[model samples]
Target: MIEANKLKMQLKCPMPKLDFDVITLGHGSGGVLTNKLLDSGVFKILSNPLLDERHDGALINLEGKTAFSTDSFLVSPIFFPGGNIGELAVNGTVNDLAMCGAIPKYLSLSFIIEEGLTMTEFWEILLSIKCACEKAGVTVVTGDTKVVEKGKGDKIFINTSGIGSIHPKANISSKRIKIGDKIIISGNIASHGMAIMSVREGLQFESEILSDTTNLNHTISALLDTFGDGIHLLTDPTRGGIATVFKEIAQHNGVGIDIFQSELPIDNQVSNACELLGLDPIYVANEGLFISFVDESIADDFLKTLRNDDNGTQANIIGTVVETHPKQVIMESVIGGKRVVNMLPGEQLPRIC
Candidate 1:
């Protein structure tokens, strides 16, 4: 027993300088480390006020009042349970504009295909892109394609740029958040992350997991139609999950967030798989989920409107913004304790859309 305890203690010891000799899958995870790499390495050199704000979609003062955003998709296993990379690329860009309270109008697509890729697979991806555009009420205005030598590139890589019209009454920003505001989550967390992980790791459960990759503009429009300016900030929990979103909001707004553990909506299968893998569902990616910051007075009405929509059936008021702790996120445990919900230090799962 003494020897076993010593072995466990040694395993638990922290290694401060574990340099990555080669690129690992986690670099693409879109978690804390990914953000750190981008901010420190790239953003530092290209520093500009516009990019500094780091909003989902760049809000530019265009003559025609347009919102623009771009995103690249490289999710491995290209195809997954609910959707594939094509659908993800389209929806991801569309939703980025929607998060800025814009109506997505047009999109430009660029593809990088590897040599020797099957034409059938490429056709299927194109079909998915077409279907996604139809669902989002957008058009593929123009596109470009290229093929790279085999082994030099993945089977496929997609980059999409989108343009949209901003809502007149919509000026959502994390900086507008106040202490008494409410935090609302659109639906269950960690479904997409788990689905991708399951397929990649060959983990099987009784119930099949599905990715929550869908266009959320419809739901966002519905909520905006009802609440208008009551919504302070809107963000979809994508790569870094709910914890990262909360941290960003809190830091940007100069406020703290306090969430109730029991109020978080999590699907049973997702929770079970997360537990088994020693992961926290709160820090897992969720493609089709969003967090809304709004005033406390209209919290019920907002939640009611969201629940009435199909995409927001599991919507709930999970937490509140506070002035205490200034720029941190805290979660009240189900056992009547509190824990700091820090931003993930590194990636949990990679190539998860």
Candidate 2:
């Protein structure tokens, strides 16, 4: 499901006519072509007071504690079922800040475009970026753009850096996690990875599998607002999937993780696709899912509250911190068995943001 963004509304702008149809090497030269591209496209759609300055860097103010994060997007087939590289880049950085218990405020967007990419494609991407920033309630402050030869780059790659003010009540840290803390997942698992795989492998199911790429900052903010320091640690299982994230946390914090296969939430289509592809959904990458380690006392309330939110209708209490088998993750099977969950030994998917 595409979770509704309280900040996003219908964008009524139409694409502007451009002098050129496709990007050329000259567009990256910091000369006339580059200026024209920015004037007609990037600057026009993403215009804000700070981005309008067109300076080498942006200036902004901050109070109290702050959180900063940066990430790059290179998802193959930049346009996926539910989103494109543009929004993916924005959501990635914004969610990164959210994971740190921050209210995201500003972003720096940079694009590396291949010479052969069409202007139409570029404009759609810019529109996505604008919509994503608006939905996340953030602004594009400063950025750089460069073009590469056809073979030197994929269609396009984006990098975003973001900063935000930390939530006053948030005390998110691994060290804060305790033996009885409950692990709650924001939504279903493996949708994003299976969505990409469906496109790459030309597999079709009863319905289209859309990427779960929506921004999670708002959802996270609401949780922090209510739970405060009761929320110990927050993390999004992006490239490495939840298993790897749990294993890392378990080893790093010297605690045992106990999860149940029966309680793990996953989409029917995603699970079927993973099975057909001989892939384990638990090891697949995800873009819009987050795992929260919260105090056991508040776990039931946390899961109930999360389930009411649009972004977390499918939330589940998947696991808990334990004292046995320290530095390891153990999952009870649907049958009466247990298995060790470890870090992914090799790359399961590539070019997936």
Top TM-score model: 2
All candidates: TM-score: 0.81, 0.97
- Please report the candidate that would top lDDT against the real structure: 2
- The runs of at least 3 residues in candidate 1 whose Cα sits more than 4 Å from the true structure, single-residue gaps closed, are 1-64
Candidate 2 residue spans exceeding 4 A from truth: 1-9
> What lDDT would candidate 1 get against the real structure?
0.79
**Ten-residue stretch with the least lDDT total in model 1:** 13-22
lDDT of each: 0.79, 0.91
Per-residue CA lDDT of candidate 1, range 226-294, in tens? 899999989998998899888877777679999998999999998999998998998899887888999
RMSD of each: 15.1, 1.5
For residues 196-222, could you state the per-residue lDDT of candidate 2 as single tens digits?
Answer: 999999998999998999889999999
Error of 1 at 72 (Å): 0.6
TM for candidate 1 is 0.81
Checking candidate 1 for backbone clashes, the offending pairs are none
